[model samples]
Target: MKPVFFLREALRALKRNAIPSFAAMATVLVTVLVLGVFIPVVQATTGAANEVRGKVIADVYLKTDAQQKDVDRVERVLKSEPMIKSVEFISKDAAYKTERERNPKAYELLGSNPLPDTFRITPGNPDDIAKIKDALAPEAAGGGRTVIDPAIDEVRNREEDTNKILAVTGVVKITMALLAGLLGVASMLLIANTIRLSLYARRREVEVMKLVGATDWFIRWPFVLEGVIVGLVGGVLAIALLAVVKIAVVDPLAADFALIAAPDTIDFPLLIGLLLVAAVAVSSLGSGLSLRKFLRV
Candidate 1:
């Protein structure tokens, strides 16, 4: 009939099946809580991984006797490459000064600057490091020594260190993505099971309505509304709990730890909105699907 009738029916069903309703609500709360905590953690972790990837760079050492024109030519070539993000040139004097600052005693014994002019190259993607290096100095056709420009002394990209960083960050990203997917599937199944229980508890009522020529939609509305109410209540409760945790634990810890206070995290209001929407949508879908089998009667 009217929407009010369905709403009333849903409320009555909840009151009649208090224990089942509570269980279903509790399930939703737990699922939402896990997701709420997970969203920001994933963001923070991904941000950190990207920061590490940014450090993967290639250093091109120019010949000690190379002229300014040679250095300019090398810079132009590097800048024209599509995969290269940036190229920074450090003169021999600057390099020597920096080294001397790090260790005054080591440089004091030297009569002149020993370091060569260098080009620091950052790639658009960390994985393209080897490609960039190979492009600069390709190996001979028969696997002989790498060929290079006459004005370049060497190209050192620290392949081993880059590989280690890339491997760790790649694994971290893949693991986080897989874990998020598993959690999503688990949440949906848990909600479905809880909704199924509620449906089983009122199977006879559904069958009676079906037998009395009531339309399926007419019988389904109340149960669907019931699910929505449960989900809304559960999501609200979860948000409250999360707020308490954030204020009581996270805020204090963040104040002391720069890592915890990273700017890459999702905004709290946006995260809360997402969790609430996810809860309602999942609950409604679970209830509707669980009610389908009973409607066939």
Candidate 2:
């Protein structure tokens, strides 16, 4: 079939079934919107969680005066354990200076530098922080070093709490993604079935065309093109819905949550493009589904 002929026939079919076509598009749009919204929400939550994780300092503080060997040894110990991302050493001067800045009157009260040097040791295994705390704290106290491990106590007590909160949020995101995917598939199936019904209603015309010696391509191209148009329309509508949800529903909630590691908020142009792609997918799925029952063409 000529491309123009297919286009003309597709357009004609659209005009003849405007109501059902629009209904199908609307449902598909809603489904796609759910998926779009779910993605950003999960990203935002994860980002915020990372931000919180950054706030979690080490449990043990090792005071080192630029001793590369000591710092390197501590780093190796932490890394070899498991799940420890990194360990860093903070010089005595830096820690003292930071303390002074934090307490404006510390200099006047102490008369001189009272802060000790420390190693900010992050644990490789979150669970190991406790074992490390038990093993290391007594050593710090026994070593008679002026430095202290304040964070060790905090980590020993609060690691489980932090892990629980993070785990809950992660699960929420996963659940949302799964739900969105299911809905999207449901929407596609519904659209395909709708198209199938429309094809069945016009079955007599298709059979007559086949009997009159019309080529399969000539008889089928128009319907396939019609499905594409519907898919495109649905995709466009889905994007529009996503825009409104992002701006009005998501932005306010995500403002404080979109920290490092979070999925950036949806941009309008990008969403439109995604929607267009989704539209094509919907159209193709619906076309293929409908064709299975109307292959006589």
What local distance difference test score does each model get?
0.91, 0.64
User: Considering only N, C-alpha and C atoms within 3 Å, which residue pairs clash in candidate 2?
Assistant: 59-152, 62-119, 82-124, 83-124, 84-124
Q: What digit string (tens of lDDT, one per residue) describes model 1 on residues 195-261? A: 9988998899999999999999999888889999999999999999999999999988888885533
Query: What local lDDT score does residue 293 receive in model 2, on the 0 to 100 scale?
Result: 57
Number of colliding residue pairs in each model: 0, 5
Per-model TM against the reference? 0.91, 0.69
| lDDT tens per residue, model 2, 185-253 | 776677777777777777888888888998777777888788778777777777777778768876676
Which regions in candidate 1 have their CA more than 4 angstroms from the true location? Answer: 142-150, 260-263
TM-score of candidate 2 relative to the true fold = 0.69
* Best lDDT among the predictions, by candidate number: 1
TM-score result, candidate 1: 0.91
Candidate 2 residue 107 Cα shift, in angstroms, is: 9.2
> How much is the lDDT of residue 58 in candidate 2?
53
